[model samples]
Target: MFHWLEKHPFFFAVGVFVTIAFAGLIEIVPNFAQASQPVIGTKPYTTLQLAGRHVYIKNSCNACHSQLIRPFKAETDRYGDYSLSGEYAFDRPFLWGSKRTGPDLHRVGNYRTTDWHENHMKDPVSVVPGSIMPGYPWLFENEADVETAYAEQLTVKNVFSVPYNTPLPMKDGSKVTVVLADTLSDAQASALEEAKLVAADMKDKSVQDAVAAGKIPEIVALIAYMNSLK
Candidate 1:
């Protein structure tokens, strides 16, 4: 068979291509699947965090910031650790931006606080001197679409099995369970409760008042989402 194939270059080339392709698939597929599983400590986003993710996408924050951190000295030094594929297992549509106009936020929740995000969203320059990013004053005024966020949670939970109610392991050897309310009203109430926690750390009166009134402003949701990045 080897001698016969050598006599015909076309067949030989085809045989070689098939052999290589099969070898590549065998080597790649299993590793890819394993790497794509959620990391030991990774958890699904809560209702408020998911709502904030909607706001983040709605405002095109992904256009300026990237969630991926490359395995490089400079990137790791600035953006915490390098990103792992398992870390994004729960993200329905990954936000690994192509270009970074601002900075990587995969670990921003570790370094940045609620108050810092509040001030930065209201006035970017106030928090970071000489920041070119524009203030998103409208986020503070607009009411967060909690209903829509809840709808997405249901879709992902039912269709994708995101494990919202399941207990997830953490790096510190603890477990955390993200609740996905069975009803829309319950979800909204839970989101409001989470928003109040974020509002407590913020100095913005309007944001605080809105959460107090049982209304979630976009800023609060956005902050919750931002804080969950870690």
Candidate 2:
């Protein structure tokens, strides 16, 4: 069979390409499928967190901070565990940033609290003295686009099979579900409900008033998104 194919240049090239393609599939497909599974403790982002992810993206937070943590003893000790592929299974465009003007935020939720984020975003130097990261006072003034976020959520749920509203297993063997609202208004309400929780931990009256008035500030959404990084 090899001799016969080698005699025909066209057939020989086709055979080589086919062989390489098959080999590539073997090396790539299984790892992809396995990595795509949600980590045992990983849950889908809620309406508020999803909106905050958008806020983070809108302000280009990923440009300054990476969401991925390298597997080094120094890195894990500072940034918690090394990142896993399954942990980002639900991320549409994973924020595994390349630059690090700030810090690795893959496990920010593990160490930082809501109040801490509020203070940090408002004035980075306040939290980390002499920090070069600029303050995002606009995040406090701007409102999160929960509408667009919900639309994107609907698209991912229907087309991508993101497993929203499904019970996901936790590290401690408990189960949690993230609901995607049916109506746009319901999505807004659900997002507002969660924003209130984040606001409860925050000291900023402006952020609190925005959440109470059913207007989620970009900072609130960004904080919620950052808090869900774990």
Candidate 3:
């Protein structure tokens, strides 16, 4: 067979191509599957966080900021750590922006505080000197659509089988479960409970009042989403 293939260059080339392709698939497929699985600590977003994500998307935050962090000294130093593929497994559509007009936010939850986010969203220049980013004062007034967020949670839970209300393993050998309410009313209550926690850290009186009255502002949800990035 070897002597016959040497005499036939076309067949020899085809055989070589097939051999290489098969070997490549064998080497790549398993690694790709493993990397695509959710990272041990990765969990689905809660209702409030998902609502904040909607706000983030509505404001086109991804256009200015990327969630992906490259494995390099400068990037890892500025961002918390290099991004992993498994970390994005739960992302419906990944937010790995092509360009970064602002800083990456994959790990902003770690370094930035709720109070800092509150101040920055209301007045970007106040938090960062000479910042070109515009303030989102409206976020403090606009109510988050908890119903839509709840609908999304239901869809993902049913269609994609996103693990909700189930204990998920963490990197520290601990387990954490994210609750998904059974009804819209319950979800709103849960989100309000979370919003109160974020509102407690903010100095804005109006925002605090809104949460106290069982209302969730977009800024509260946005802060919840931002804090969950870690």
Candidate 4:
């Protein structure tokens, strides 16, 4: 066996290098190669979605849950549309992940009823019975507050390229509203507050609707991010 190994030393070295390179490369590429026939719809993450993603990162969820779905026959069948590159265009760090301690959460957005989510958030075992995952009671208990926090992050000033400081001219061109915080007036502050409230209300309604319908809230921006996973 030792003599055979020495004779094939070049092949062994090449194999080791190839394996390491492949492992590192997989972290960037979306698994579109394994996707079903036609590509699916996709979109970018909204500000709130981005914040939720940050939360996911802060919790180190990637350490245990893999976001990538392999292109194998069984994998494609189980995970829905295969992931694509354009799907994650808005992602800053990407979440292909490194392990699968839990099930693949590629299309998790589409799974489980809203109540199931609420229950799982309250106590995983209440829903999954034997789920090894820890319950996130805080997520449910502070639902409104957390949602408000998410909405606050989703404001256009934080996510889009609006000139918050440049003071956009109104349709009548009579007055100006600064885009940035350089010279925010009482009215501007009120408008911003209203916008935030609207966003929070939308998020709250989404969750309520999802619970009532026995489905998860699309959470507009969150839905945009999830559907983008292809």
Query: By TM-score, is 2 or 4 better?
Result: 2
lDDT of 3 by residue, 1-230 (tens): 99999999999999999999999999999999999999889999999999999999999999999999999999999998899999998787889898899999999999999999988998999979999999999999999999999999999999999999999999899999999999889999999999999999999999999999999999999999999998
Q: What is the lDDT of residue 200 in candidate 1?
A: 95
Model 1, 47-148: lDDT tens digits are 889889999999999999999999999999998989999999989799999999999999999999998988898889997999999999999999999988
User: Candidate 4: which stretches are off by over 4 Å?
Assistant: 1-40, 141-230
* Candidate 2 Cα RMSD (Å): 1.2
Q: Which ten residues in a row have the lowest lDDT in candidate 1?
A: 202-211
- Stretches of model 1 off by over 4 angstroms after superposition: 1-21
Give me candidate 2's TM-score against the actual structure: 0.96
lDDT score of residue 205 within candidate 1: 88
Best by TM-score: 2
Q: Could you give the candidate ranking by lDDT, starting with the highest?
A: 3, 1, 2, 4
> What would the per-residue lDDT of candidate 2 be over residues 121-216, giving only the tens digit for each residue?
889999899899999999999899898999889998999999898998999999988899989999999899898988999999988887888899
Candidate ordering by TM-score (highest first): 2, 1, 3, 4
Number of clashes in every candidate structure?
0, 0, 0, 6
How does model 2 fare in lDDT? 0.90
Alpha-carbon error at 73 in model 3, in Å? 0.7
Per-candidate TM equals: 0.91, 0.96, 0.89, 0.49
Tens digits of per-residue lDDT for model 4, 1-66: 657757898977887799899987796344644442222233334333444465566556678877
